[model samples]
Target: MLKIEDLHVAVDGAEILKGLTLEVPAGEVHAIMGPNGSGKSTLSHTIAGRDAYEVLSGGVTLDGDNLLALDPNERAAKGLFLSFQHPIEIPGVQTMNFIRTAMNAQRKARSEEEISAADFLKSIRAKAKLVGLNDAKIKRPFNVGFSGGEKKRMEMLQLVMFEPRFAIMDETDSGLDIDALKMVGDVVNELRDPSRGFLVITHYQRLLDYIKPDAVHVLADGRIVKSGGPELAAELERSGYDQFIEAA
Candidate 1:
C-alpha cells in the first residue's frame, strides 16, 4: 500500500501540499481529480522524493516502508515510479541504454542479478511496440525531437519496462489524443496486477474512460477533501470543480 498521512510539502517558501492524506492499496488504481494549483503534482513529487518539495511534517510509507527517509533513486529501487507531468529530453543519452542501466541498477540494489542484454532487448522491443514506438524511435536519444504525445508514450514505455510496485502518473493525459490515451491505458492495464498499485492524477475525466480507476479522490488546496468510486470522476466532469474548490 502507498500511504500518506497528513503530508505537508512546500515549494520554495510557499506550502503547496497542506496536510494532504491519501492511501492507495495494492492492486487498485486511484484517480486524483483537482483544479489547478490544488497540489496534485506536489503530492506526486513529494512521494517520489523530488528535491525542493520539502516535507515539513507527516509520514509516507510504501507497504510499511518509510518513503520520506529514502533518496529519490533509493525510492526508485524500492519499486516506486513516477511518470513526470512533463517528460524531459536528455540530449546526450541513448534511450535504450538509459532504461537498461536503470533497470539493472534497481535489480542490483535489490540483490538481484542483472538482466542479460538479450533478455533486455527482447523485453524492450515488446514493450516499445505496445507503447506505439517503432524501432527507430527507441533507437533515438531519450525524448529528443519527439512530439508531446510521443514523449508521453515514452513514459508509458518506461512504466511497462520497469513494472514498478507503485506508479504515480502525474497528468499523463495532458497532451495525449484519443489513440494515445488508449495506448496509455493499454500499457497500464497490461502492467496491473495484485501486487502493484497506481495513483493517477488528472484534471479531466476523459482519461478515466480508458484506465477506469478503482476509486476517485478530490484534491483541493493540497488535501483530499472528498473521495468516491469511479462515478466520482463523472460527477466532477459534469458539475465541475467549483463545489470542491469552495469546500477546500
Candidate 2:
C-alpha cells in the first residue's frame, strides 16, 4: 500500500501540500482532481522524492518502507514511478540506450542481473507497438521531434516497460486525442494487477471514461476536501471546481 499521513510540503519556502493524507491500496486505481495551484503536482513530486520539495512534516510510505528517507533514484528502485507533466527531451542520448541503462541501474540497485541486449530489444519492440510507437520512433532520441501527444505516449511506454509497483501519472491526458487517450487506458488497464496501484492525476473526466478509477478525490488548497466513487468525476465535470475552490 502507498500511504501519506498528514503530508506537509513546501516549495521555495512556501507551503503547498498542507496536511494532506490519503492511502492507495494495492489492486486499485485512485484519481485526484483539482483546480490550478491545488498541490497536485507537489504531492506526486514529494512522493517521488524530488529534492526541491521539502517535507516539513508527516510521512509517505510504500508497503512498509519509509519513502521520504530515500533519494529519488532509491525511490524509483523501490518501484515508485512518476510520469512527468512535461516530458524532457534528451538531445544526444539514444532512446533505447537510455532506457536500457535506466533499467539496468534499477536492477543493479536491487541486486538483480542486467537484461541482455536481445531480450531488451524484444521487450522494447513489443511494448512500443502496444503504446502505438513504431520502430522508427523508438529509434529516435527520447522525445526529440515528438508532438505533445507522442510525448505522453512515450511516458506510457516507460510505464509499461518498467511495470513499477505504484505509478503517479501527472496530467498525462493534457494533450492527447481520443485515440491516444484510449491507448493510454489500454496500457494502464493491461498493467493493472493485484500487486500494483495507480494514482492518476487529470483535469478532464474524459480520461476517467476510458480508465475508470475505483475512487476519486478532490484536492483544493493543498488538501483533499471530498472523495467519492467514479461518479464524482462526472459530477465534477458538470459542477466544476468553483465550489471546491471556495471551500479551499
Candidate 3:
C-alpha cells in the first residue's frame, strides 16, 4: 500500500499541498477530483520527487520504503511512475531511445541483466500497439508534434511497458475524445492487478467512465474535502463541484 501521511509540500516558500493524507492499496484504483488550484498536481509532483517540489513536512511511503528519501530517478527505480497531463517535448530524444535508457538505468540500479535491443523493440512494439500508437509515431521525438490525446497515449504506453508498482496519472484525459478516453481506460484496466495501484487525478467524470475507480476523492483547497465510492463521481458529474467547493 502507498501511505501518504499528512504531506505538506511547498514550492519556493509557497505552500501548496497542505496536510494531505490518502491511502492507495494494491489492486485498487483511486481517483482524485478537484477544481483548479486545488493542489492536486502538487501532490503528484511531490510523490514523484520532482526537483523544487520541496517537502515541508509529513512522509510518503510505498510498502515500508520511505519514498520522500529518494531522488526522482531513485523513485522510478523503486517502481513509482507519474504520468504528466502535459507531457514535455524533447526535441533530440527519440521515444524508443528514452525508454531503453530508462529501462537499462533501472536494471543497472537493481543489478539486473540489461534488456537486449531486439527484446526491447519487441516489448515496446507490443505496448505501443496496446496504447494504439503506430510504429512511426513511436519513432518520433518524445511528444514532438503529437496531439494532446497522443501525448496521453504515450504516457499509457510507458505505464504498460514499465508496469510500475504505483502510478499517478494527472489529468490524463484533459483533451481526449471519447475514443481516446476509451483507449485510456483499456490501457489502465489492462495494467490492473494485485501488485499495482493507481492514483488518477482529473477534473471530469468522463474519464472515470472508462476506468472505474474503486474510490473517488474530492480534493479542494489543498485537502481532501470528501471521499466515497465510484458513485461519488457520478454525483459530482450531475451536481458539479459547487457544493464540494463550498464545503472545502
Candidate 4:
C-alpha cells in the first residue's frame, strides 16, 4: 500500500537517505532493521511528511497517490497512521478530546460522518483497555506524566481506534517491556487485514518475535541493502549490523 522509490532525504542540508527504495504491499508487514544513523527514522518522517526532512529526490506514494504533494494531515485523512518513536505530550490537550477531534477531522476530510460522542467513548475505552491503558490514564492530558511503555500503549490505542489503512510503526517497541511488546503485537495482529499494510521500523529483533513480519529488510547508509524472509531478522540478531555497515 506504500511505495517509496530512490528516496533521498536531507536534514539541514546534509543527505541522510540515499537512494532508498522499499515497498509494503497491502496485507503485508515489512520490518526494517538497521543500526543508528542508517536513516530508518528519516525514511519514516519523510514518508509522514514531517517538516525539515527535505526530500531531495525520489517519490513516496500511498496506493498510487503522490504523498509528497500532500500535507501531513492530508496523509492521515488518506488513512496513513504513524506511530512515533517518541510520542510527544501536549500539556493542555485533553486526551479524549484530542483523539476524537482527530478522528472526526479525518472522517470529515473523507466526507464521512463524525462519530457520536457516545460511540467514540465506548470505542476508546475498549481500545484503551486492550492496549493495557486504564481509564484514569486515558482521562489524563495527552500522555502527561506517562511512562515510556505507557506512551507506547497509548500509541497502540490510537492505532486500533483509527484503524488506518497503512501504518508506519517507528520503534513502537522501544523501551517496552515484554508485556508491552506483546500488547503491541496483539493490536497489530488484530488490525491486520487484506486491505491494510504495516511498515515496522525497529533496531532490534525482539519486537519481530511478537509481530511476525512478512519480510525483513536491512537498511544501511540511508538505503535498503538487503531483504529476505523473517529469517533475516534472526540472522541480523546473530551477526549484528557490522556486516551491513561495512557493506554499505
Worst 10 residues of 2 by lDDT: 91-100
Which stretches in model 2 have alpha-carbon errors above 4 Å?
none
- The TM-score that candidate 1 achieves is 0.98
Q: Which whole-number lDDT from 0 to 100 does residue 149 have in model 2? A: 92
Give every collision pair in model 4.
none
Which residue pairs clash in candidate 3?
none
Q: Each model's C-alpha lDDT?
A: 0.94, 0.95, 0.92, 0.95
Superior candidate under TM-score, 2 versus 3? 2
Residue 27 Cα positional deviation in candidate 3, in Å, after optimal superposition: 0.6
Instruction: Give per-model TM-scores.
Output: 0.98, 0.99, 0.97, 0.99
lDDT of candidate 1 over 196-220, digit per residue (tens): 9999999999999999899999999
List the candidate 4 regions with Cα displacement exceeding 4 Å: none
Q: After superposition, how far is residue 145 of candidate 1 from its true place, in Å?
A: 0.2
lDDT (Cα, 0-100) at 172 in candidate 4: 92
Task: Give the per-residue Cα lDDT of candidate 4 at 2.
Answer: 91
**What does the lDDT read for residue 96 in candidate 4?**
95
By lDDT rank, best first, the candidates go 2, 4, 1, 3
Give each prediction's root-mean-square deviation over alpha carbons.
0.7, 0.6, 1.0, 0.6
| lDDT by residue for model 2 (1-248), tens | 99999999999999999999999999999999999899999999999988899999999999999999999999999999999999999998889999999999999999999999999999999999999999999899989999999999999999988889999999999989999999999988999999999999988899999898999999999999999999999999999999998988
> RMSD in Å for candidate 1, one decimal?
0.7
Residue pairs of candidate 1 with colliding backbone atoms: none
Q: Looking at candidate 3, what is the lDDT of residue 232?
A: 96
